[model samples]
Target: MRLSLNKDSYEDVNLYFQDEARFGMMNHLGSYLTASGVKPIVTYQHVFKTTYLYGSYSPINGDSFVWEINGVDNKIFEAYLGAFSNYKPKEYKIVVIDNAGFHSTKHIKVPKNIYLLRIPPYNPELNPCEQVWQYIKNRFKNQRFKTMQDLKKWLHEMINEMKAETIKSITGNHHYVNSFITTFKI
Candidate 1:
C-alpha cells in the first residue's frame, strides 16, 4: 500500500531481503595454531559444508527475518518468494536483489503479487542485504564449529538475537533510500 502523500513514480515500496549465506567449515577463516617453542599444529576435523540460511528484511516495517532453509536451490528461492509475498500481502512489494542465478532460473516461479527489481549486474552495493550479512558474519569471524548442524544452530542463534532496530540501523541507512525518505517525508 502506498504510504506517501505525494504521488511519485517511486510508489513501489522497496523491501530488501531474501539472501543466502553458507555456514560451515568453508566459512571458517580464522583458524590459527600457536606453540611455545616448536610450533604445535592445530588440526580441524574436516566437515563438509552443509547449511544455507535465507533471510529477508522489510525496510518499511523494520522486519528482519530468517527463513528456515533445508537446502539451496531454485525451489528454495521460490519458497522464499512465496513467503515474502504472503508476508506483506497488502503492500505493493518490490524486492531489490542482485541477479543471483536461482533468482532468475526457469524453475523459480515468482509470485504475481510480488515484483523483483534486479539491480544492475555486479552492483551489490545497491542491495543493503549484503551489508546485513557482512554484519552477521563479522560477529562470527574465526569461529570454529564441530559440525554442520552446530554451525546452523549458531547461525540461528545469532539471527534470532539480532534486534529489528539494529537491522534497521545497519540496512536501512542507504544514502539514496534515506534521501528519498527525507524528500518525500516517507
Candidate 2:
C-alpha cells in the first residue's frame, strides 16, 4: 500500500510493520535504520558520520541507490528480505517499492514466495514513503548534535515524544477513502 512521508507527514523515514492473521508485524527501517552505536558511551565522530545527506535530491528516475550507513547496508537489506522469507505467505499478493537502487538491485537468491515490484521510476507519489521522510526530517530540522550517541539518543527520545495520533496521521492506512470511490468491498 502506498503511503506519504511529507514533513506534514512521517518524515523521510520508513518503518516496516509486518502482519498476518495476527497483524503480528515487526517494524524495520526501510530507508535507513542505522542500528549502530557505542552502547552507553557516546562520541562526536559517530554523530557526524550519521549526519550525511538523507534526501532524494537530483532524484533521477532510475538513480542507483544503496542502503548506506556504516557497514550495515547488507544487514538491513537481509532483515527486510527476511520479513518476506519468514512471514510472507507461501502465496501472497504483490509487494511494491520505489525504483531506488536498493530495491532494484538484483539478488541471486530472490525468494519465490512473493513478488518484488517497483513503483515506476520518478513516481514518488505512488509510494507514500516520500512524505514519511519529510515528517522525519522536519522532526530534526534546526537541530544539531556533537556525537552519534546524541543523534541516536535524540531520535529515540523524539520518537517517544511524538504523539500517537500524529503517527497515525502519517502512516495510517486509509484504504477506506479509496474504497469509497470504488464499488468493491475491501
Candidate 3:
C-alpha cells in the first residue's frame, strides 16, 4: 500500500487535510531530478526532508509508491538493499514492465546486474500502488489539519516519530488499514 494525501470530512464537518495540500506544495515545489525511474520527490520543511513518490500532477510527477515505500523514507529502501546487498538476485536477461510513461525512461542509470520491471496498465489487480494510496488516505480518519502547512507538518512529524509503524502501515500490514480504508466509505 501507498500513502496519498487526500481530502476527508468527518460527518458533515469540513476537514483540514486536503489532497490539495500535498499537491499544492508539490506543484509549488516543482521537480528536482530528471532522467530517472521512480525517483523519490521530497519536500524540505525546515529541518526534515521527507521524500515521497515522484509528483505526478500531469504525468508531470511520475509513478507513485507501493507497500512500505508510501510511508517510508528513502532510508528504508537503503536498509532493505543493505540487508539484501550480500545476496544475489535471480539472473534475468530482458526485463518487462508496464508502459506508465514514467517507467519508460531509457536514460535512467541502473546497475547492469539488476533489472527494472513494471506490470500491465489498467491493471490495478497487478499493481499494489493503488492499494497503498487507499490505505494512506484512511490514516487521516476524523482528524483535519488547520492548514496545508499543518497537514504537512503532521505528515513530516508522523514519518519521523513513527518510522517503524509508518513503514508497517505503508506496507499494508497494519491494523490501521481498516480504519484508513473505512474513513472514506463511512
Candidate 4:
C-alpha cells in the first residue's frame, strides 16, 4: 500500500515496526548445551505475573523506543504512543504494526506526529519488531527471576546495553529495508 504523508518534507520521516511482548516468571525453554548423552534438565516457572514491553524499532537506522507496562489496553497503548511521540518530536514516524485489539486506531488516539499502519491480519512475520522480541526472549531462556523487580531490572540493563549496530543486525531485514526504500523513495 502507498502511504501518503501529510508532511511536506520527508527528511525526518522514519519507518518503525512496533509490537508488544510479555515477559514474566515463566521461562522460555530453548536449546541448552549439555553432556553428549545427558538430557539437560531445565527449571520452569508457572507464575502468571507478567509485564508487557511495548517497543518500536526503526530498521532503517536501528533506532528503538521501548516502554514496560503492566498490561495491554487501549489507554496504555495511547500513552505509549504519546511517549514515543515525545521521544522523537521532530521526526514524522510511520509505525507498522499487527492488528492487535489495543492497536485498533478507533479506540486509541494516535499522536499527531505518528501514523499507524496496520499490516494484514495474521502476518506477524511481516513486522521486524518480532525479531526484536525473539532476541530478547531468548535471553530469558532457562532463567528464573525471584520477583518482578528483578526481571525488570535485568530487562532494563539488557536493553540499555544493546547497541544500535546490534539491533540493526537483528532487525534490519533486507526485505523490510528495500520496502521502506521503495515505498518512501528514501
Candidate 5:
C-alpha cells in the first residue's frame, strides 16, 4: 500500500580526480621524478558551476527516474510526483522521504494515489533510496564531464545498463525494505 518515494539531487561539478596510480618510485636520497608521481589530470573551464538534477527512486522494484531542474520548489515536487504516478500507476503508493521543503510544502498537491511518509529529521542513512545515490555517485566518482548534457547522458546510460537484479542487490538490503517485505509479503 505504501511505496517509499525517495527524492534527492545529484550535481555535476568538476573537481580534481583522485590519484589512481598505485605504484610510485621512492628514491634512496630524497625524491626523484617518477612516472606515477606525474599523474594525468582532466581540467575544466569552470569548477564552481554545477548542474542540478533531481530524482525519485523506488526501492520496491529497483526503479529510478531523474529530471534536470533549475530550482527545487513545491510545484516541481508535485510535477515529479505526477510523473512518478504516470511511471508506475499504483493504486495506493506510499513514498517514504526526508523532510525536504519541496516534499512538505503546503502548496504542493499530492495525488490521491500517492501518500508521503516522512522519515525522522536529519536521518538520511535510514532511507534505502540513499543507497541509490551512493551507488550512482561512486560509479561517477573522480570523473569530470565535458558538459551537463554529457553527464546526463552518461548517468542515463549507466542506470539503463544496470539490471533490475543488480539494483535490488545494491539497494534492497535495508531494514525498512526487509520489514515491508516480511509484513506485506511483497
Candidate 6:
C-alpha cells in the first residue's frame, strides 16, 4: 500500500525502504587478481551458522536503523518494528518492504507511528534497499571468517564505518526513490 499524505502532512512523514540479509561462516568466493596463467586459491568454510541483519534506509536523508537479529520470525519482526518505531517517535514512518511471510501484518503488531508498504511480490528491484545488500555482500566476496563472532564483528565494523554519503550514493539514485523524495519534498 502507498502512503496518502497531504502536503502539510509531509513534515512528519519519513519514507524508508527495508530489507534483511543473511551473513554466515560460509564464504562467498569471487575472482582475485593473480599473475598471468595462475589460479588463485581462496579459503572458505562450510559451517552453516548464520545471523540476520534487518535494516531500514531513508533514501531522502540517508538515515538508517538496523538490528542484527538471530532469526526471522513474526516475533522478531514485531520487535524490530517496535525498535524502529521508538527510534524516531516524532515522525510517521512509511517503510517499503517485501512480502516475506514474517512480514504478514496479521501475525505481528505494527507500531502506531509506522506503516508498511509491501512492494509487489517477485519485484525486489523496486526497492532501493536491495542495492544496499548487494553493496555489502560484494565486500564479503573471497573473504573467510574463522568464527561467527568474527564475521559478525567484521560486518558490524563495515556498517558502522559506512558514511551517510556512501549510503546515499548506493541507494538514493534510483528513479523510484527520487520520485518519492521529490513528490513529498522529503
* Model 5 C-alpha lDDT per residue in residues 65-175, reported as the tens digit of each score: 666555666787788778766654543455677777667658777875566777788987756666665676666654566666676577668767877676667666557
Q: Candidate 6: misplaced stretches above 4 Å? A: 1-11
lDDT of 1 by residue, 22-111 (tens): 766654455456765666444455567667778877655567657856687777788888887777555555567677887785657777
lDDT values, one for every candidate = 0.69, 0.39, 0.34, 0.87, 0.55, 0.85
lDDT assessment of candidate 6? 0.85
Write the number of the candidate with greater TM-score, choosing between 1 and 6. 6
Predicted structure 4, TM vs. truth = 0.90
Query: TM-scores of the models, in the given order?
Result: 0.75, 0.47, 0.35, 0.90, 0.70, 0.90
Question: Could you arrange the candidates by TM-score from highest to lowest?
Answer: 6, 4, 1, 5, 2, 3
Residue range 44-155, candidate 2, lDDT tens digits:
2212154221212111111111122233233445454555444423423234456545454455344444345565788766554455455656655445565566665665
State the lDDT of candidate 3 residue by residue for 64-161, as single tens digits: 22112233333443333333222333321112233554343454444333234455567644433443345444554434444556656655554345
Give the residue spans of candidate 2 off by over 4 A: 1-48, 51-75, 83-94, 108-115, 160-164, 172-186
State each candidate's clash count.
Answer: 1, 18, 9, 0, 5, 0
Q: Rank candidates, lDDT, best first.
A: 4, 6, 1, 5, 2, 3
| Candidate 3 C-alpha error for residue 54, in Å | 4.7
Indicate the worst ten consecutive residues by lDDT in candidate 1. 1-10
With a 3 Å backbone cut-off (N, CA, C), the pairs that clash in candidate 1 are 1-91
Q: Which candidate is the best by TM-score?
A: 6
lDDT of 2 at 74: 36
